[model samples]
Target: MILNDFLPVNKADLLKLEWDYLDFILVSGDAYVDHPSFGPVVIARVLLDAGYRVGIIAQPDWNDPNSIDILGEPRLGFLVSAGNMDSMVNHYYVSRRHRETDNYSEGGAMGKRPDRATLVYTNLIRKKYKDKPIILGGIEASLRRFAHYDYWDDSVRRSILFDSAADLLIYGMGENQVVEIAEYLNNGIEVQYIQHIPGTCYLTKSLENLDQYIEIPSFESVKNDKIQYAQAFKVQYDEQDPIRGKTIVQRHSETYLVQNPPTMPLERARLDWVFKLGYMRNYHPMYEAGGGIPAIKEVKMGIISERGCFGNCSFCALAFHQGRIITSRSHESIIEEAKMIQMDVDYKGYINDVGGPTANFRHPACKKQLKVGTCKHRQCLHPEPCEHLDTDHSDYVELLKKLRHLEGIKKVFIRSGIRYDYLMHDQEDAFFYDLCQYHVSGQLKVAPEHIDETVLDYMGKPSGKLYGQFVKKFDQINKELQKEQYIIPYLMSSHPGSTIHSAIKLAEYLRDINYTPEQVQDFYPTPGTMSTCMYYTEIDPRTMKPVFVPKSNKEKAMQRALLQYKNPRNYDLVYEALILAGRQDLIGFHVKALIKPRTNVPKAGGSKKSKSSKRKTPSSKTSINSIEKTKKRR
Candidate 1:
């Protein structure tokens, strides 16, 4: 049975009943959204498919101990995870600025700290069942696998494995590693035995046994003495000695046991858990709270037909977490899900997103090239596009056509943002025409982060010319179809390579297109992500060196405010921004003239004292009038 099967029971009452029943209960700190995060949901589904009973606790309040009992009870099984999406309240919205420094966004520190939350959650479980396994995954646990700087606390913290009291901390992708852990536990293998498992971290009372093994130095040690770790890690995976993997020694009490490359899961196996619909509950609950229609409540809904894309945009984390290789679902499974959504009464008449990462890019381009063992290119986003890489639109066209003919489905839409550059590669332009004539709800979203070629190059995005070409083609199609649909472009500002000059160029592009977009985003750096590290430290983790750093606050605010040029308040910000950019020549021009210049005049001392503070002198006439009134009363 799936997790939603227990919804009929009262959550408070359910907490009071069972103390020790569930084989494994997974708790998530993040609101269980269908976004790639429901990794625990995926992991739980996989375990259930393997014939083990599993349950999930989504968005449990760590501050409330009662929420822990909702999982029923912990038993002899594994607790898997990726940590909470937001470590604290401040992390959720970038709009909130720090009190002291009008510059930095407030660091995430409002909710219960992860280690403390885990401690409280684990103690509740231990009271019911002693020594059950608890393991942590996700970006938080993975990046914090070793000692690292804590910007919130302003100090280095201990390893999360030691702090959270988890049996093990799985680092990278957990598909293969999680199963290995479960099988070992089922055979009555002690948690200690799995310490050597690759892509995982475990704790022991002493480091005696691991001394013989290859040691990977902590990030702190590398930061203090870069020469040692850089040289060690620079050795290519193949060139390194077999016995001694790329192990960097640093001067610290802790060390890392660097493993070889990670193991990837099969496409078929990953898709199996997805069709079971474990994440449906997670996604629905949030939409209900937010006063929006959940996917299940809608007339029609669909899951991604695939995982991962090879676009490798610098600002995207999907490529990092999901990997560059494309993993697709069988065509039959996707059609079946569409049919199921159509059957639901809530189905309004729309089929939501039916595609994955880069919706239209279907098959892996590198599969054939890799088989020949002659692949020389590291990335497909380079200047010279791969000749073998098939930028084909046939598969997407076929999928959309098939989806449109499904029973009882009225409108099939492509809601997920599409890569316009890739869409431009449609050989016959049939898909573009079909999309304009049939799909889309009057607007198609596309991401063109900036118009500057240099910034575009650094971001690994298509040239500005590519977006323009797609727009022109799309416009022609719309005119032919007599449709009033427009393009809703998604733009990112203050990315690592973007500067004030680049932002101005983007603003000019927006103005030229006569597009006033409300959907503008400032880049957010999440843990373990390449962009996040580059944003914070200005150092690339792969290279262990510095890169071009941009002034985050001023540049970010300017970018975000560009979409609101017509607003009067934006004029104040725009003027101040121009002054900061040293482009004072542009000040008091255009809309900026409406904003009054700031004044620094001091307040008068007389006005500072209020009227009530100055006592009034009572006249003799007032005293006589008071006496007469007293006499009349007597």
Candidate 2:
């Protein structure tokens, strides 16, 4: 028999395929939700733009190998970035709910975005083409480049490279680094030499190279111990150094690896691999199966009119992550995307959302110092509008009118959530009139986190009156047009500046307006964000000072429960909140009649696994005997 007869059937076929016929395929596991991500699409776009033949495998089932055949098998090494979005965060409700339970280590975790799909694809690639390279990137691979303190699991885990068996791990934005890898391989370089590329973390066989690697020093405190991990995790950026480097676990015991200060922002590329033409497939399953909101129902397929945001809500990370400079897509591209959506078999006469982080805030309201050669680091509203700033809404007005005229599109909706503060401007008022008349289907979501000035200030909101005036104007416009859409204002509770008193005021406002919001968001601190850093570190890295932190759990829970006070069971929470806030007058209301003993145990952490120290997850004892025992204890 020939030597080929010794090989497995599938492997024998792959071994005989000509390398010249192979296409450079980049598969993204990220859900194509129109947001920039750290998945395969970003890299795929780059390779495609560079003239390399590339195809994407989005949200593929990693468990199934047949999915790999969609790209037609002529394959270069696989680009296996897990997902563009964090898998854990996707499973969360509003992000503030708890995640762990005694039966499982990390329940409620929206684990593995398109990345799991990528991992599966990569494994299949290896199964066929034995020596082919498989690279992993994105948040899951990046943050856990080394041993990390997983709070929910309450243990230190091995690197994802070890777990996924990927040949390489491209940690940060895999832009320049990925390009270098492609070029190196094309030029006949081995994978070993390509590991030298910066912005990546990989394993080496020699221990001698350990000292040359970055060190975290503090990582030893938390390994094998969850509480120490939580404490160590709480440490903030060392302001003494300008770089703001990340702390990592070292290769050896009792040592930590601290990376150099964070690198400068990667210049925005013409196309990002994280976002592709059709990446939404990645999120379809989880979102369909998700709690409360469904992506199928929420997203109706529309083009993004703009990129980035300007609203600097302190609690929000959009401004920092996406940037404050607003970039509207050329009207031609948007119209083309709209035309494509009309051709979809699933077209439901409604275009889901068609705006950036904030729909109508189309242009940069303020002229930033970055545009000019010099820097004038001052607020736009501080004194008067600066010389370079043009606070105008004329362009957006024209664009809206043009879109309305498009044919075959049943209804165009603006549901990205609007910044009411910006909408209250002079030119913007007329625009709002048109928006209320045409854009809004029935409900317009506006975030008014809290009524208290202090809380609003903390959230970087303009004013309570701004929202009130907009609502009144919206109503007036609806009356004139003889339509029936209403503003659905989003409210948040237990934010940083919130108190029991402020919560009562918010509840009272809801009562007065007779507006019980369909959703109430509670503040959650995510890792590597400014708000989380503030909450955990208690010091502003910019100012080098401490900030106030309300350390009362009772106060926090009461504030959160106040918004849901209509239920008789919530009376205990609402009554206590009012009394704590020194508004005892509210105690005599229907809130007093529903006082009952608390049955549910208080849950902590988030739907995402907490990278904290070992903490026992609460057991859900539903058995009748267990219930009776629990009831007796209560």
Encode model 1's per-residue lDDT on 1-634: one tens digit a residue.
Answer: 4443322122443455442355567765543444333465566666655655666665455566676666555455546443433343224445444322111111212342343344445555555556777777765666555544444553445566665667777755566677788788878888767766655666544555544444555556544544433333333211122122332222245433333333342465556456655434334342354543232232136557776666767666555355555667777777877776666666777787777767776767556632432232355644435655677777778888888887777888887667776666546787788889888889888887778786677677888988898888889899999999888878877676565556666766776776766767777654434455555555554456654445435546665675555566566555545454445654444643322444434458635544423423223333233234323433
Q: What is the Cα-based TM-score of model 1?
A: 0.75
lDDT of 2 by residue, 1-634 (tens): 1121111112223346322344465555444332222244456655654555555555555566776655555444777655544444443433334333211011223433332343455677677667777777665566555555332343455555665666777755566677777888788887765655555656554444434433432344445544443344333222111123332334434222333222233333332222334433222232344332233234447556665555656666553334455556666666666776677677876677778778876666555423431122333332223455555777777877777788866677787887676666555467877787778878887787778775676566766766788888889889998998877878888665555556777888777787776667776654334444445444443343443333344555566778877776556556555544445666543643223333434346544443322333223222223223323433
Best by TM-score: 1
Q: Each model's TM-score, in the order given?
A: 0.75, 0.66
Q: Provide the lowest-lDDT 10-residue window in model 1.
A: 100-109
| Candidate with best lDDT | 1
- lDDT scores in order: 0.57, 0.54
